[model samples]
Target: MDESNNNIKEPEKRAFLKGAGLSIAALLVGGLSIERYAVPKDRSVPVMDNFPLAILEDPSGQPVTTSEVIEFAGAKTTTTSSPILVFNYPLQDEPTFLIALKGVKITTPNTPPSSGFAPVPSGTDAPMDGIIYDSTTNTSILAVSGICQHLGCVPPFLDYHPGQSVPFESELIGYKLNGAGVKKWPDYGLIYCKCHGSQYNPVWGGRNLYNNGPAASPAKHSLPQIMLATDSNGYIYAYGINSSNAVIRTHLNFPGGETYGSGVKSEDLTGGTAIRQSTRSLPANLSLYKNTTLESVAPSSLGTNQSSGAIILYKTTVVSNENKNGLNWKGTF
Candidate 1:
């Protein structure tokens, strides 16, 4: 009886061990499934969508023609200033910089050098054709997001530095005329950010033009270029954003969970109330301060439905730049 009992107990122990092993294996498989489906893959490509085409409008609510942009840019350039026109597209709250590169024909093969950070979405590594409208002269008109990629800073802080005219911040940060300094600055003016000194070369598809300075660019991506088209009537229209890998600043163009929506980036257009027309043009020579205010004016005042605002311009008074310590400055209205 004892021998029989031992034999039965041995078999029972083997069967129990086998069942436990199978249960553990099942749990391991289940855990893997959850992990695979729950968490998104890192650096997953953003879902690309074509935003609705918007007509480019002036402050007067009229269709802005290419010829007009060129003419305005020429007028500004004659005074050693660059035109920085602000308009909203694809979304009401998102402002874009509509600029014309005077005496420079922006052509194809303007692909920016890879920074080796963000994964370049397929088919976007090339130049965006038909976006740059040839003005029948050296001028070429294009548009880009006004928001800085380093931080979400807007106009006046991220305005263009035209030709040889360097911003005080740009000068301190080592940008020089004709690329004369240790770090070469482009001959054409860059889109400079005074907030943190980040710079973008608009000629090179708004690529980040990093400089050697204490306040180097903290941004990793280039400015998203706005796609443009022109009708036979010479009217320019903003159709969509360039389907490039460079994501728009502050638009939540990241991977993983859906903030805007699952795999829907164009839905970002839904949140902000659309700006009806361009804001008043600010001159490049005016001294800009962090405390400068935008006083809103009634739509009726502008003779349009667009709510307009004016930036109070100031002149800079530099006290000293002794010892190359940076400019000691004050603003006077």
Candidate 2:
């Protein structure tokens, strides 16, 4: 009886082993087939075409010239009331700052010497590479990406702070006028980010001035500059983007991939509808820490036409106090 039981057990074990072997072989074959089909046949890098030259237009469909920007921004010392101009270039959803640094004359490829600060490496274009100059008045006009390099904050949270005019948020974050005591900040107007305290020097190609402060610059790269040009008629046009290696926030193709060289990725440029025109208007009072009141509403005609490929540039009036109507105060002083 023991011998008969052993014989039956051996045959059953053999049958089970045969079945397991077949299952494992089938799985391996299936996995190989899937892998073969899943591999992309074309692994070539995408061809990125150069962006088309887009004319900067105001809300009224008029071309925005360098002279107009200089006049609106005024002189650096007296530009306390001038509003930050906003526009879209290359793509409609990509908001850009159109700034004239008051009395500052920005020269091309304005990369500062690497004395104590890390300058942009040689062979790469600096933020000033995109500056447009008015030959008649020698006024310097520049456009930089409005999106914060840290966390993609838009205007108001990532706006410019002119000299002598300190925002409540700026003072709270330790950015003084001219960086008086701050070792990290520059001694001039900065494109400051209130979100995480990233400060960019407008005079030095939107270079990030990060070191030691209550709120230091969290961004590792400078703001991407938009290449500007003027026709014989003095109309400013955005032709391309400089600082191609510095990726624009929210404009990345892959999850964590490098941007296409030559200042822009053609695939990204064509992803969104191009904004044909933008108007000079006040920024929205969206500060959670402060109460804002609309002093004077911009023209409703231009504001309502935002869906028609036009952007309303909201003027930012950051004040020292909070709970005030129309005053944009983001933090305590």
Candidate 3:
């Protein structure tokens, strides 16, 4: 019985040795496979995105300036679109406007929002980059390119907010208060990009203050401004290139044809309306708090007869104000 047990143990040991030799052979042959299954240390992935203010090579081989002659129906004058239009006034030697023909539209390149840059749109073209100046009013003029700053999608002038539109909210991150000092849902303005719910401020430079979009976001940027131009003869032209580049002489033609509108005169803008109100706001009140008693502290009774409160309201009968961006207030308390 002992001899038989020994014989069984010898066979078991031989089987174990065979299995171990096969395992070692497999390990040497499959070493690369083990490494292939190893976990990766860097998990970061890159994404492709568009940028606003992307410096395109000024439209490859395209003329920096162009000229075109078009006749508007019922108008006796013929307007010539030209780069020379930028220097309409002797004092203003640069173009400050871009005019689109009646139905024609212009697009800008893709740009990041935080960078205040937006992707320029495709399919729209202007003989000259949109930049213009108005000699008649002594004021500069510019128009928005139809493209959205959030994505390359062009925004429409919808009567109401689009379903997917991005509403402009505060950048303060937390809940915001309203003008009434009541804590309210954050809502500032309507600058919705429906494709991805990115909201912007339309009145100010197109600023992306809210985000509800893809991982790729806009940088700290604003919409690239398209400049417009007006010649001495009142011809309006638009181009994307800056006015400082060496002049390229070509007749800038509007492929979609030209549109025309008589600019509103300064007097016409005011409609000769009578000055019924003032445009002056009072200075802020600066009164220190007073300690009335051991148990009572009162707000300074000092107040502005003109305006007072958390926000100072002001009204004035103004004869004139030289400051262009100054606040013009009117009210009676």
TM-scores for all candidates? 0.56, 0.58, 0.24
Evaluate residue 222 in candidate 2 and report its C-alpha lDDT on the 0 to 100 scale.
74
Q: What is the C-alpha lDDT profile of model 3 across 1-333, one tens digit per residue?
A: 011211111110111122223323434564222111211121121110100111111112111221221111112122211111111100011111122121112222233234322222233332223322222322222333322333222222111131122234222332233345322332222333333333443222212233432223241233333333332333332222222221111101212211112110000101111111112222222211112111111112222111123222211111111111121211110
Once superposed on the true structure, which residue ranges of model 2 sit more than 4 Å away at CA?
A: 1-50, 75-81, 108-128, 178-187, 206-215, 254-256, 260-267, 276-333
Provide the overall lDDT of each model, using Cα atoms, as 2-decimal numbers.
0.45, 0.46, 0.22
Q: Which candidate has the highest lDDT of all?
A: 2
Give the top-scoring candidate (TM-score): 2
lDDT of 1 by residue, 51-99 (tens): 4344565433456667666656655432212545666544433456777
Better of 2 and 3 by lDDT: 2
Cα RMSD of all models vs. native, in order, equals 23.3, 22.0, 33.2
lDDT of 1 at 91: 45
Q: How many residue pairs clash in all the candidates, one count each?
A: 1, 9, 56
The C-alpha local distance difference test score for the whole of candidate 2 amounts to: 0.46
Tens-digit lDDT string for candidate 2 (157-253) = 5677766566676788765555444533343457876555677766555344444445657777677776665554566656556644365655554
